[model samples]
Target: MLSLQDYSARDALDLAGLVRSGEVTAAEVRQTALVAAASVESRLAAFTEGPFEQLPAHSSGEFAGVPFVIKDLLITAVGVCGHGGSAALADAAPAEADSTLMRRFRAAGLGLLGTTKSSEFGLSVAADQKWRGPTRNPWDPQRSPGGSSGGSAALVAAGVVPVAHANDGAGSIRIPAAHTGLVGLKPSRGRVPLGPWQQELMYGNVVEFAVTRTVRDTAYLLDLVQGNAPGEKYGAPLPAEPYRDEIADRSPRQLRIAVAAHGWDGQALSPDVRNAIELTASTLADLGHVVEEASPAVDWEGFLAALTTTWCAGTAAAVVPLLKSGTDRDLFEATTVTCAEVGQALNPVDLAVAFDQYNALSQSFGSFHAQWDLWVTPTSVGPAPAIGDFDADNPQYTAAEWVRRCVVPYPTCATSNVTGGPAITLPLAQTADGLPLGVQLSADLYREDIVLRTAAQLERALPWAGRRPVVHVTTETRQR
Candidate 1:
């Protein structure tokens, strides 16, 4: 049997190695995972569904025996209906078939264990759902794990799983990864498919991937799951080589790297976050790369305005159907209702203009990247916020007001989402108190190769393998 300590120390790829080598059977690995998950359930309310009596059966492959979970939004697996941590769809029916991503995930040899929580419709960076309560951070239970992928982040950080599904629209994957000490890659738009169900999410701003404890896991998973689905509306360029091979070079080619030590939107970064950015820039410089301070010229307010317009409009489209079907309005979060109303009232011209702004921003980023190979910045203004810092249920906030208060704080995240570029958050640094603060590396569209290689170099140089959350599987098990 795999002990808790042994399981927690090994990443997904390592576990698969164990299984593949016949050191342990897949069933034993899964049973150990179930025990680990059961031990921490109360401390982190991370799941919307189960460590079921029987998970969907998966086949032998790269991650053959590794347990995994999907965010309870956007992606779906057969026999599991993600309510998306919402009261509005508490009774939603199970998905009849696997979504394309789920199919790919299963085929990669991952055990589809269950679904994890999301903010209602993934509306907030904090996973404090009004009905389901908050998903606690594993590092500090009183603070968030960052969301709407909070649930996934918590489990991965606490060592219940080495990697799990996450998606980013405006940093859903990266924000949580930043806070939770994980590797989150929001791949180039269309690098990971979302299809047979729909073409794009958040008007091509959203992309699906997962949070992992190692760069190898992120790169390997991308290799396993990335490609365009049948009839997909967009397709990111194929990688030059396998992503795993891309990260294998220790002496990666030196390039011009721009560092944004200060927030692009002029929001103040905490001393810890600022220090991390400085140290990361210094480290990159030490590694023979040209690091200089620079930022892309962007119409910040205009971009946010356009984002708010599209976001609210998308919310309205999703929620209005539920309301018309006689689902009580109160069942939806108050902020959700307000956003829906704002979205519903928008003219077609308003939405079109918003998309035009996206195109303009994409061009702006393209020109900026022409001067710089990669841009690095703090993933968040600081570490995870106290659990109550964001109140999604507050009716006082208008939709725009909510965006300003909650979304604007993490200012650097939405840029790559806007440009359809590849961006990654690596847990390169941590605060004095042990909370992880991530440093983001971003490049132009379809350049995840650069992002992954740089991240792999950082992972080797400033390794985070010794860091463990307070509520981790090893810690909790040893105490018991």
Candidate 2:
């Protein structure tokens, strides 16, 4: 009598193993996931629609029979119209077929549960919505869960699922994972396919991946979903073997790790975040890895400006179509409006110059990676902020001022996006108040397997899987 509620109690691997061992069936897992999703939906508002039907049929893969959720921004079920957290496209039609990623997800045996919420157009760092309201932190409903993958992170951290799909353009995945104490990895650009639509979004900076409870799950999914689809402009070189095999073979090789307590913009890292970095560095050193404080020289101002230009340009492109359809006028958030306006002001020459500068920054990092095997830094400058911290409606500060205050330690996690490198944020530390702190580990481009293997080693060394949030589903509630 394994009911729908029990799915939330175990990780994806556990559920899959249960099915394989005859302890439970795939249907039981899906039912449990749906029940768990229903229980948390109202309080967290993580999903935009039903805890939808399972995949029509299980396929052949490691995670076969496991249940999961996809972020609404990514296409999943046909005719399941996704708003991307925007009311402007509220009437948008469901996609006619599965996106390439969705096809792979199904082939690998992950039962699609439903779609999660995202910031409007995946622009904002906070997942607040003018129509659906905010996706509250399961740990502390008053605080943010982080965005634009806020809803995905919330559900995963709240124990609603073992893992869920999350994409990052600028810290969307890592920020939420840091806030909620989950493992978030932003794969090297082109490592995951984006097809039947476009190759890269946000000018080659954004990539899709999953936020998962375990390192192996992230590695497994990457192996399955990464490849150039029919029309993709580029793809990463395939690994000689599966990523799951890499995780299992733990080689204790000494790795040269460069550590930076300060952010890319040279902003002072908060004591808590700095301490987390220092602690992780020490742990690495103890593990026989060569660790030292160092970072390649970076032109922070130029990098930040270029990032803004690229982001604004993408924003403009997205909104222009909506405006033509008379849909642009419906955007609810003030920041979304401001972003579009800023984007429209840029000319072709300005965009070209920005692209050139981005290239220069990436080259500089390439030179640095020639010296170090990995670079370690704090995932964020400080701990998570309270709700409404980045509210665009607040008149206390202009949009520019708001972005400055909200995105402290400018280019902390965003640097990897600029460099197109593989990075992972591990929940290795916690604040005095019990909020999780993350340490970021980045490797050369296309070296995600190395980064993941390193993460798996550290996961074993630190053993963070046992650390549960103070605010979580109670046994009494789970029993219900």
Candidate 3:
């Protein structure tokens, strides 16, 4: 019998192959995940609830029963209520039906294990939510796991499952992955469906995807879910070939890569993150790729303004639907109310101006790509901050103050979100105290394959699977 210790030893693809080969049943894998979730629930604060019941296997699906967790935000499950971490919407019924993306996840043979917590309205960066508390970092439980996808990242990092569903609007996937030592690939906007409930979100800024332990899992999942649903407002440029196949083909991976060593907003990277990126740049050079210092020229301040515009506007729309009275507004944080008001006060002329700036920012990256194949940078300015560093709900600070504090560690992240490019964060180093450190590789629009190839090469050069966090389910890690 395979002991529980053996269950988390492999990534999802490895387990799925075993499940398909009859060496282990799908139910066994799910039970292992559930036990892992239960074992570390208090310490890590990952999922709100999980239903690990075995589902009938589908012969056509690639995963064929691999256990998976979707974020309790935009995506819905049959019995799982997707409250999206809002107090006002707590009683919202279980989704009448799964979203189109969820249907694809199921069609690909992934078993629905449960739903993970999300930051309220997917608005905050830190994991803390009034609804589910914080999704504690497995690397160090007292520290924060970046969100709104923090719960999903925490579960995968702690070995509850090989991968989990996560969506990125403004660094939610990559930020959490960087903090937790996982591979977070934010595909170009429109690369994955956001539909059946929404055709576009935040003016095409949010993209749905997963964070995983291996490049292959990221690639495979991309292949599994890469397309537009019927009547999607837009679709990504279709891949020339499946992403996994692009990885397996291993075409010569030499190209000019632009590397930025400082924050866009003048925030200097901490020594640890600085060292990691410099080392990564040198390694890329050694791997036969040309490395140079460069970044796309864009209006950073204007980009921020537009992001605020769309985010606040979208929040207003989402929250307004759930509000029935003035008291119902109490169910949300003060920042939420302020953002909605600001968003609601905007006119079409104001929105048009912001969209124009957004498009200009996107084009700046487009022109820069003509000179470089990808851009490399430190994923964060420092190791994970302590949990209370970004208290969006705190009345002591305004919403803008909270957002500024939250983004200081990740000033460059939102640029990619606005530009609609593909960015991947990889764990290649650790802090002096053993916290994970990540270096990001961002490729131009529609070039996810380039980033994947670059990441795969780096993964081989500096393998991270053997390195384990201290707060793992298999064995509790001693905190520093």
The top-ranked prediction according to TM-score is 1
- If ranked by lDDT, best first, what sequence of candidates would result? 1, 3, 2
lDDT of 2 by residue, 1-480 (tens): 465335555778877788888898777777766667767666788887768764448666768778778887855567677887888878778888888888888887887777888888787777777767888887777887888898889888877778888899888889899888889999988888877677778888888889998898888888888877778876788877788887784565788999988865677877888888888999999988999989988777776678777777787788877877677565656666676677888898988888888888889889989989999988887777677776754535444554454455434678788788999999999888888888889988998877888888888888677666644544325545
What local distance difference test score does each model get? 0.90, 0.79, 0.82
**Tens digit per residue, CA lDDT, model 3, 1-480:** 345577677888888898889998877777777777777877887786665555545645887757889888888766678778778777777777878888888888888888888888788887888765778998988888888899999888888888899998888899999999999999988889887888888778888999999999999989988887788997887898888876674556589999989885566778888889888999999989999998888677787777778877888788776664444877887777777777778888889988999889888888999889999988899888788677767766554555566555786787788888999999988888789998999988899989998898889888999877767768841221
lDDT of 1 at 259: 92
- lDDT comparison, 2 vs 3, better candidate: 3
Clashes of 1: 0
Top model number, lDDT: 1
Q: Which 10-residue window of candidate 1 scores lowest in summed lDDT?
A: 51-60
User: What lDDT is obtained when candidate 2 is compared to the true structure?
Assistant: 0.79
Q: Write the per-residue lDDT of candidate 1 for residues 330-383, one digit (tens) a residue.
A: 999999999999999999999999988888888989999999999998899889
> What TM-score would candidate 1 get against the native?
0.99
